[model samples]
Target: MSQFTTPPPLIEDDIVQLSYPAEHILQIKMNRPKAFNAMNNALNAALEDVLNWFESEPTLWVAVLGSTNAKAWCAGMDLKQVNLGAKTMWTRNGFGGMTQRFTRKPLIGAIRGYVLGGGSEMVMNLDISVAGEGATFGFPEVKRGVVILAGGLERLVKLVGHQRACELALTGRNISPQEAKSLGMINYVVPDDQVDAKALEIAKTIASNSPDSVMATLYGIRITDEAGSARSAHRLFVDSAPIKQVHSGENTIIGVRAFAEKKQPKWVASKL
Candidate 1:
């Protein structure tokens, strides 16, 4: 029983667009080019819907979150919308519907420009991120008399440490993609033209592996963020439901059999 009884509409108006670049790989593009892909209430709801569907559709093993327009991935919250009384910038999942989520599958970021405020916050929680050279990220909430409340504060501090997170969030200064990569906030920084390709390449690689194993691996790694201690995380990782499913599932045996036969394994969609 897949939870997603309805298939995605494939395109979500001018807010979000969905496509499959390869088998088992989904690309979610922010499409609000006129406002630099800024997140308003509609955008938040649309993104949340798409992501919820992606998570439920087990065949979709990995997703790349990016922008359709080159000028900016997201300019953060649409202040004009806010000024006009569109105060709701949140969904059930939080800012942009993805920032505060704990997604079971891998979500990679493909960003190049103007990843600011909530934009930067969304990137903070992605499993892995690839940015283009032109990408600039910052938390400018302080300057606007708001705060980064969408799980960015906790994840950013855990990612880059208290000192660096303080400088980035408190000062409201932008960091280049190169700086972000150096600080381990992002996995790679490549040419602007290759941002999406790089993210897709990684997604394909992940999708080629056993889906159950991949999901279990992601669960094992992400549990550390909430498990309190290394030992606790380790204990939870070994005993977790996802790991148990992977270890006992058909894919485990299939993987071993394929290895023994020296053949590329045909993976099944995970039921995590």
Candidate 2:
């Protein structure tokens, strides 16, 4: 069994609270509820630092990201903290330390209420999203005389395609969670109180799998999304070191022997 460990002192920031909801599952609660969980400089930095640690932590396999309250997942960038044309508003990772971050591990979003501008941008980048029935999604940057420059414009198009993205992004119209789900932005929609639970449920399922396989699967998805075609991505996956590592790793042998023995397999901490 995997034992929970203490988070490093750097992740002790109030803006980002880290906890283990289950073995191999990291739960990140954005704690700026007073400001509707807006992504200011401090929150962005805290999230980036914690996520950096999460990615490198051998015992951790998946993460569930949510806010402290259900009234709003996030209200987007804080105008009070960031002025127009200012590059300092962004961390090395784009909006919310997530929109532009190239993450290897899977991240599940627990979302509700108004998620606008950069908030929705972060949604597009999540591996899976579970939202409340009343959750709202929008890119309202255009209404503020700004544009979705924090990787939202391109990602939005990829998520829902050109016409649907333009319709919602151009008019700055908000859509219900159901509509977002139909458009492939959300995976599950439940009551507001159930959002976090559903996300955790998904996270634990992923956590139960061999970490090596999970990382390799995500890597394949990343390659497919970036490559020109299925054929190209398939070829890359066949020749990739990640695939080779999974084939030659100890977990593979453990899995095979466990199946033959008719018993549960104890996954080794992934060295990938």
Candidate 3:
């Protein structure tokens, strides 16, 4: 049996709280409610640290990102901090230390209240999202005299049709959770109190599967999603190293034997 080790204690003064609610689930919460959980130098660094830790932990299977504030998930960047010459907003993994990172592990976002500007951009990078009934999504960068440069624009265009994405980007208007769901921006919209529960439910379902298979599936999906064409996607899927790893992993044999014996499988941690 594989021994599970506890993660290290989160650093003091961490604006983002990293906690393990379950053996395989890592929950990261933005903790600056007074500023609406705005992304500042401290918050950005804290988030980067959490993500780096998650990437290194082989036993962890999924991550859930959310905010502690009730009024807003995140109101976006802290202009005051930025104007004061705080440049710690961007990390090697992009905004919020998540947008650019390529990891086989999945991330799910639980959002409520306002998700504007960079908040909305961060959602674009998540594998899945669960929004509260009061959730509002928008790209208001244009209203602030800036462009949506955090990869939201391209993702928005692909998520909804080009026409709708253009309207949202140009007008800087917010959309209700229903509208966002209709546009395929989020996977689920539950009552405000149930947002976290709904996200956890989904995360648990993913975590119960074989880690190697889950990683291979997500890896293939991401590669194909980025390939931009049927021919390219097909080629990428065929050559995916993660898929090959899954086929050669012990978890595959364990899964088959468990299924045949009518028993639950004890999945091994995926090294891919």
Candidate 2 lDDT over residue span 1-272, tens digit each: 26535354474458888788788888898888888887888888888888878888888899999998778998888876666554555788788889887778999999988799889999988889999998889988889998898887887798899999889988998889999999988899999999999999999888878889999999999889779999999999889998999999999998899999998889988878
Q: Which stretches of candidate 2 lie over 4 Å from their true place?
A: 1-13, 83-87
Model 3 earns a TM-score of: 0.94
Which residue pairs in candidate 1 have backbone atoms (N, alpha carbon, C) closer than 3 angstroms, thus clashing?
none
Model 3 per-residue lDDT tens digits across residues 1-272: 13445464466676777767777899888988988877886777778788777766788899999998877988888877877886645888777876676666899998988898888988888899999999988988888888888677787898898899989889999889899889998889999999989999999999999988888888777887788897888788877787788888899999999999999999878787
Query: Clashing residue pairs, candidate 3?
Result: none
- Kindly report which residue pairs in candidate 2 clash with one another: none
lDDT to native, each model? 0.87, 0.86, 0.84
- Residue lDDT tens for model 1, 131-153: 99988898999999988888888
The local lDDT score (0 to 100) that residue 16 gets in candidate 2 is 85
Relative to the unseen true structure, what is the C-alpha lDDT of residue 202 in candidate 3, on a scale of 0 to 100? 91
Q: What is the C-alpha RMSD of each candidate to the true structure, in Å?
A: 2.3, 1.9, 1.9
Number of clashing pairs per prediction, in order: 0, 0, 0
